[model samples]
Target: MSPHFPSMAEPGGRTLGDEEVAAAERVIRSGMLSAVWGTEARALEREMAELYGRRHAIACSSGTAALHLAVVAAAPDPGDEIITTPITDFGTVAPILAQNAVPVFADVDPETGNLDPAAVARLIGPRTRAIMAVHLFGAPAPVDELRALADEHGLVLLEDCAQAWLTELPPLPPRPATPLAAVPRPAAPLAAAPPGDAGVRLAGTAGAVGCFSLQQWKHVTCGDGGLVITDDDALARTMRLFSDKGWDRAAGRSHASFGLNYRMTELQAAVARAQLAKLPGVVEARRRTAVRLLEELGGLDGVRLPRPEGHAWWLFPLVLPGGGAREMAAALAGEGIPARAGYLEQPLNRAPVWSGPVYGTSRFPLDGADAGRGPTAACPEAERLVADTLLVIDWNENYTDAHVTAVADAIRKYRPRP
Candidate 1:
């Protein structure tokens, strides 16, 4: 009875169907391959923006580029520090560096793996310009608290919505009665708030801007592309110029500032347009599959499955109880599943790249100016998660119940070799 056979299965490989192929082919035939005001890209942006309750959406080359543009559009001054979670894709951090802004790493909550606002508040300083909250693994961060914190401190709030496109978070609850025995509950929805108004709002609409990824592996695949959604018309226009090499499309001339060519190809846009149409279905499938997996993995000792929420479930992350994420990953790999432990490195702050002159550590005034500051001091919770996390293979609209069961059973049977 080799559990390996059952455990090693994956969701079926994804492919573009007839409609997608037609869209791509149409773009190929049109010869308007580069960025242009076309129906396809426009429609895609409109649809996605509407989907996320955003006023505008600007499609870009990749998620990283979208983040960079969003940071730039938010207009944080050079050398300003942006507080962000360490538990995220480097793309989320790279954009901060690209703007010459320092990324002050704030730790995330161990359970949700999202930026902890309390941790962020502790780390905020004079130069804190913005808070880039990444909704890790499709769970929306506590955006409302982050928003209030941003308002209190006069900081910009930007969302890395690449993981969470259409997810809505429950509101934070109100404080309990201290002296009194109990307080009467508020009306229906209001009563559900978390204690101390700690709940987060949805990423895009709540924050100043939200960014999304349509990378091939994401629930919606546009081959490789990203988008920035903002309610600020002026910022949206500026970002358009930034994406188009500082060219003011209206004037048909180059602007003063040097901007990068972060435009998305029409081909990608066309494909994205079609994909956006299917996002709801794709997201639903991933959610259904994840629900099944969570149920199957329930109550398994030494395995911490992610809690279900109104999340998109990008990656199925499991935290091994006995501190054997690496060994568990290896055991799963030996069984032929595409499982892997968390990042090989510690906090990005500790990475060699950050220590060098390239990251401007010598030039900037971080709290620990001389000592290389790591999340160990600032973000103990995130550090713990980084050490204990493991990932299972996931994709858009590809998973089945059988696949979910297999992954759960694999986790149940995994035993680290001594």
Candidate 2:
């Protein structure tokens, strides 16, 4: 028999239930598979909007498409530099290129893996137009600070909450830090509770725009879909129109500008709507398991896990700054635990498209002369974090305390001796 552990909780497997299956079946029976103008797509939008306490949530084909729509709506200028973290999926930066913009990398917090606002502040230049703060691995970046900085610098603050569905930054005067599982939560209607009550707000609600992924591996999945949440009505309309080929539904179906077909199907929307009601449970499960792991593993030599409070625990990322991520991962694998070193092998700036010629040697975005100057070294901390020390294990809504213990045991098994 193979020594590798069985995959525990993939997004689709853990979250997909009777409601999701029934939702899809109902959509199939409805005879209206596509909701180009109405039905489930619209319902999902309203549901997600209300859930996050946002005024608008626009549905789209993919997370990348949602981000692209955000870029198209808030930043349309070519060569505009968007300051973002290097420790993120390409979906975060791909949209910048789609908008003919330059993506500038800012270093990340070694602890949380979220964008370091100070690094972002330093990276801001004359051409810089926006700061895209990714809630990396479900831990929120200092978004309120990023927002204030954006206002101070006249730059847009965009929150990429693709992996951070229910993650929130606690209200000011955060209570004495407690494990996420022990934090007293108001019973029932968690989504309906206003941010003022808990002095806490969801990660995506603070920025000029927020993008979420409902991809297969994300916290929630509609097979493959995306949602754009924003408080600005004009911005929401722009995003909606942009995703719908610039055809403003309110404007008698007239095309307003150049756009793309990034519409989500009604089938996907039906599943997403059903999935929304269960998101609180999804987040709770991951948070509880994550908190337990932190409690057990905290203070372990050569291992660093971010604070459990306010983190969504999308993936249980750990940093071994002493540097044995890959070897540790392999050891964990041998012990019937799953893990991998580095979320992404390198920063976004080092991606081939960044330094490579744009078209026939005309590299307008990276550099007019040499595309090699794409700023890969802009975030050395992120490079080292990924290349030399980061390792992550799957975290999901189905993980239990036992699973947490197993993971912790595997990590300690491979813990490097001082």
Candidate 3:
């Protein structure tokens, strides 16, 4: 049991305070809570779109909804295959299934825990239609190569940047003839392999479309909101309709294709705008603490930090040897710091629900009523990733240097505990 720390009682109320309250009050006073008109949601969308350098941005109810809209926007045919990494939240894969598309599990780079382009190449087949690269734990994957691969095969490249917000990473590396084969990458999620920089690039800006989460745990929170960014005007228009149940507000109740009601409310939008304003400072605080920790622990024999430029430091992940991450987590917990031994309970491929029938005996994608589940041996490298290392720390923008030092000292005090 951890004792209460002085930092725990800073009176930060969910990143909301007088500022957000004032914004909400203004929205309420306007009497237009819907996003259809020139309201808070619309303004938030405009600001977000411009912020990311995207021509259009669509606000939705959740990050999962944003992904679903992206799938629909791509217009994937039934039974089409989308290659993605398994080391992610269920939201990442659920969209493919919702669109009646098959999710082809691809191996990930052990160091960054990102989709390995070569592994994705191996999985590409006749049914392949798209590839999704998740910036796992806020580190940039090999986006240029993935984009090139998608272009070569006429595939749509979608980026899932849930943990990555404002992550300016390395420039595109030289295109490899083939992506290197995946090996046993220990704590690839925590210890990213540094990609030499040619210049700087943002995480979600690399692909044809990028999805981001603003859930409570993310870099910024609108309580629970999501944003989608894209340069294609027509595609953006289609996404707007998809998010609003196929109704074109500009056309006055005109209907287009079938869609869903995934609109972000004015209240959420109001708070989102406020949060966005504070994001630069939020990011800088985490960056400073993360950098200090790196300097303190980087040379500790078994410790390593992520590539400086590419990592957003969403989680201050550390790769530890042996199987003592659980002990480390417990010890940190005792000191009032949070830690986790592994990223997920299990890789998505091995999840029980994924192996079962969907929509009551319909498994067109995974098992097709025959196997009723996808292949278990898929994404072997992903399996090794979680089993091998520990995420020694979790990050928040409010954490100060003292908090970071406490984390480092705790880890140093205990390691490879038998």
Candidate 4:
């Protein structure tokens, strides 16, 4: 008998359901299908903003567009430098080049696969304008320390929350003053807030702005959409104009500043709004599924399960013990399991396009070279993960216990020799 189970083969084909279909149809029936500001779009922005505890939210066509708008709103000038991790999708780095700003690659912590705030602090220099930290694989980064580094350097902090929506940072106790400490603590004890409330701050809220993706595989699917959340009113307005092709909301007209047509469609917004209603449930389901899988796969000599988090699970990425990511993915695919590499592609720093003459101009030196020389050094950690991480795609709210067992059984059955 074949060991394959139907549930494990395809996890995310489940669509929005009858109510969502009805909502989308109503929008289509209204004869307003384009990117004009409408009820559906506005409602999604409002609800998403409330979810992240931000003052404003702007929806765009894709996560890449959200990053572009955020970068443009934050930098707004050529030759500015933004420090970002090399382990992310090119979409994160594309916005830096789109604005003609230089991207300084920062290595990630091998354990968390997130940006190292210490590396970011070390990279800060005179031209540093912002630090964009990616919360890789649904785990939150060290937000408090990153914010402190950003504040000390007087630079903007941007969060790539595409993978980590609604994820909260761990509580950090207040540091005690030492003999040479610059500041001392107050004498009176502060009133305790709520229990969970004591340490919780949403991922993007810690930075100057946060961007989220509502793509097909994300926890909340909008087919293809993104949102930018920020407490800065001016930055919010700037993003609105940038996303709407330079239309100034205050003046109610198109402005001279260059912008793009990155607005999300009304239909997408309507579908997303419906999905938003189910987001908390979906996130909880993903978390439970991840826990079950981790338990089943525990004690494996070479494989590493993603650390469980308090929020949504976007992707369940496993690191092979011996570093043969491609080999493991191919082996799993042969067994009718839909496993693949960790990301859509490798890091942007190693892409040939980045090394080409187009981006090698004096304005943007390729690794500080006068000519278009290759990257100064290979991003070994990024390369290792790219070469060795196997990704189980599109974790859904419908995973059963049998499905988890099947996955663990397969991994155990096919133990690769070191």
Best by lDDT: 2
Ranking by lDDT: 2, 3, 4, 1
TM-score per model over all chains: 0.84, 0.90, 0.88, 0.86
lDDT by residue (176-254, candidate 3, tens digit) is 6654565455664763332323244677777878998989778888778999999899889888898888998778878
lDDT of each: 0.73, 0.81, 0.77, 0.75
Candidate 2 regions with alpha-carbon error over 4 angstroms: 1-12, 173-197, 359-361, 369-374
Per-residue accuracy of model 1 over 210-294 as CA lDDT, tens digit each: 8889886676777689999887898888787888888877776647566899989889999888877777777777789888877
Q: Arrange candidates, best TM-score first.
A: 2, 3, 4, 1
Candidate 4 per-residue lDDT, tens place, 1-418, comes to 1244333224334447876898799899988877574688888999988776678999999999999988987774576678888877778988987897778877667666678887777677777888888888788877778889989988888899888877777666777766767556768886454223455677888887899898876767778999999989989988888897787766767485778899999999999989888877776777887789888878888777777755467667777757776777777777766577657476655766765554545436344522221233355666677767545444667777766776677677765666
Q: Count the backbone clashes (under 3 Å) in each candidate.
A: 7, 1, 0, 0
Can you list the residue pairs that collide in candidate 4?
none
Deviation from truth (RMSD, Å), model 3 = 8.4
State, as a TM-score between 0 and 1, how close model 1 is to the true structure: 0.84
**Which candidate do you rate higher for TM-score, 2 or 4?**
2
Error of 4 at 296 (Å): 1.7
Better of 2 and 4 by lDDT: 2
Worst ten in a row by lDDT for model 1 = 1-10
Question: What RMSD does model 2 have?
Answer: 6.2
Window of ten residues with lowest summed lDDT in model 2: 1-10
